[model samples]
Target: MMFGVNSKILDEIVCILSKDTNVESAYIFGSRARGDFKEYSDIDIAVFIEDPNKRNMIAVDINEINCIYKFDIVIIKESTSRELLDNIKKDGVKIYQRPF
Candidate 1:
């Protein structure tokens, strides 16, 4: 378990996210990814999906795992601005990816 987060928790989160066919990938960012979280720090997650319209659906599925921990979810599209995507890619820790 990296950054004090339980592997099982990450596994469960990945499992839940994987259920959504629209989701292409998911990453953990912010404090959690940086390994410097405080007591009340929230998990920052970035999800990449093929269909922007399905973002809300993916968020709902992510929220279902919120009981395990507080988290903020950001949905990203292929057309998302390069700057933001680059920042996330540089700092975020990838946690899930759809199987081929």
Candidate 2:
């Protein structure tokens, strides 16, 4: 598995995001995504959704999942910074994107 983290974690995360119709997409970035993560490395999850409040709610849902590492959730938006967006797009792994 990726970085020794539980695959169930990713499965549950995608399941949660897929349940939410508003979520346009989701990605896993940062050290974990790059396969250079240490034991203390946290999982960086970027969620693309319309409602900021709803996105926060989704983050809460994800946080409910128990794990050894922390989950750093970021909501992707039009107002997101170019640098971060570029990094995520360039290196991030897309986990889920709602069907059209």
Candidate 3:
């Protein structure tokens, strides 16, 4: 229930993401975060990681997980477009972050 009470898939997604030490933080955006999801809607996730090169590793890890929902993982970085980053930051729901 990271994004909201209706998002059960998010809990499972977080478990997979949390195991990766490179992952700094994560957010959920798009229809799922807005609470207007259909049965087949993919969960859009934006992640800030320690190394951008680790993006592929993260994708493989997430894809291997047996989950009912599809996850679209986006890597957020300084080089990423300002407009797209702003939009996600504005609407995305914070779902995970590494503990200090």
- Scored by lDDT, the top model is 2
lDDT score of residue 74 within candidate 2 = 90
- Candidate 2, residue 77: Cα displacement in angstroms equals 1.5
Better of 1 and 2 by TM-score: 2
Best by TM-score: 2
Give the Cα-based TM-score of candidate 1 against the true structure.
0.81
Q: List model 1 lDDT by residue over 14-97, tens digit each.
A: 888888888889999888888889766787889888788743666666677635577788888666788878778888999999
> TM-score: which is higher, 2 or 3?
2
Candidate 1 vs candidate 3: the TM-score winner is 1
Could you give candidate 3's per-residue lDDT for residues 8-38 as a string of tens digits? 5556678877988988998888887787877
Count of clashes in candidate 3: 0
Quote the positional error of residue 62 for candidate 2 in Å: 0.6
Clash counts per candidate, in order, are: 0, 0, 0
Better of 1 and 2 by lDDT: 2
Q: After superposition on all CA atoms, how large is the RMSD of candidate 1?
A: 2.2
Pick by lDDT: 2 or 3, better one? 2
Over all chains combined, what TM-score does candidate 2 have? 0.89
State in Å the error of residue 93, model 3: 0.8
